[model samples]
Target chain A: MTTLVLVSHPQLADSTSQQFLKESLPDDDIIWEHIESLSSLDVAQEQAQLRRADRIILQFPLYWYAAPAGLKQWEDTVLTRTFVYGDHRYPLADKELGIVVTTGMPRQAFQRGGAEGVTLDAALAPLAALAHRAQMRWLPVFPIYQFGYLEEPEKLQLVVDYQRYLTQPQPDSLANRQDWFAQRLDGMVARLAEDQRTTGRLIASVFEQNREQIDQLHDTLAMIKEQDDD
Target chain B: MTEQSQWLSQQIDQLAAQQEKFTDRAFWLALKQVVAEQDRRSEQLGGEVDGRTWRPDRW
Candidate 1:
């Protein structure tokens, strides 16, 4: 599926987190749109881009607990009533809306009794509501906290995970994540030399065995529930 | 096996051992632990942790 990442950082060149994320996303099926550069966005062309994308990600550094002015402007200008919410058909219907936000403070600071006193979800409620109004599925918000404090290894992991998040199908579901890992394991096994296959098989076997046990446990729970009801 | 593969295999073995006596709670705990380890390894390998999904009701 095509993904459109509309980045709205005013000073994206100076931001470490935004730069890293932009660099990590797969270039093939993903389109990157810097909102600051779209001051004169052609409504038809922009609408066409949205039409082609199955997922739209709003990537920005959290500014005063909300998106920068550029993104808000883009939304106001591009998502007209006729295009998004009028008698005309909604071009964004059934499309997924995802938010990628970066913060200077640690994640804990955004919780209750913390410095910010408002949860991240509370801060981004408007975006979620906007997705609802536009008939789009609101995916979870991805928050990068204290980007400057992350070490090299953490940064590398973030790149890998973020790339997967951007490219993987049905990324919000746990089952899909499991499938992604399983597929990766299978691919690794396939590429192994003769002597290395044993280790790969061992790992795959563990996953299979654990899945079977989990399934059996689920069955047992179902049976117990049935018995209790009867 | 390469060092990375060996480390992964070891993790699988540990997870398998935990699975043998897995209760519902144990399963969830094990899953959480595995996810934590993956995050830790990612950091060790110079990878960053991606953002999480946020729902207002959960707060």
Candidate 2:
């Protein structure tokens, strides 16, 4: 899938989280754009990028619970009425809209009883509404809270998690996750050092075996349930 | 966990340790987590199958 990641950080180079994310981007069919970098908005080109992408990610540090002003400006310029249902043709229909939002506060702060007193969903309601109006599928928001405070392990986890958010299939189920990894296993194993290739291949083989075993068990359980139902 | 599953995880961990790149290590380690998940799911599904097989009413 071709994922379009539009990052709207004002000072892209200064934001450590944004820089880390750029480094962690998956090597695949991806298009990365920084909204603030563009001197002028090419409306047709911007719309074409939106049309080309299977999944569109809007990444930005939360500014008072909203995206940066640059993203808002881009929306006003590129997302024209006629292109997004004004002409009765939903160009973005069935495409996925994902948000990768970074917050200064911890995750706990984005709840009714927390310091921020509002959830990410509620804060980003306008974007959600836009997705609805465009008949787009809204992905669950991927929030990076308190990025500066994260230890090494959390950062390590975030690398893959962020990549998956951009490229992995929808629903984020174990099945889809397995499929995602399975698809990449061969390439990962192939990239291993010569001495480590055997071990890498062995590990991959075991993973695939476990995957198949689970599928078999699921099938068996389904059969049993079917029998019981009759 | 099954012996085989444990062995697989150990191999993955060792391979992850050998990788110099943080992201590469993360991928291997993350795959190990999914392997663990697969084992748990297999056990759950196996138990459900066993539970359904011996239902007295069905028999």
Best by DockQ: 2
Q: Which ranges of candidate 1 are over 4 A from the true structure?
A: A26-28, A167-173, A188-201, B1-59
Model 2, span A1-230: residue lDDT tens: 99999999999999999999999999989999999999999999999999999999999999999999999999999999999999988999999999999999999999999999999999999999999999999999999999999998788889999999999998899999999999999999998999999999888888888888888888888887787677
- Candidate 2 stretches with Cα past 4 Å from truth are none
Best-fitting candidate, measured by lDDT? 2
Which candidate comes out best when scored by TM-score? 2
lDDT of 2 at A95: 95
- Give the per-residue lDDT of model 1 (tens digit) for A1-230: 89998999888788877877776775448999998976598888888999999989999988889999999988888888888879657789999998889898898899999999888899999999889988998887888999899975466557645655666666545445545555555654555456656755776665555445444554555665575476
- Weakest 10 consecutive residues, lDDT, candidate 1 chain A? A171-180
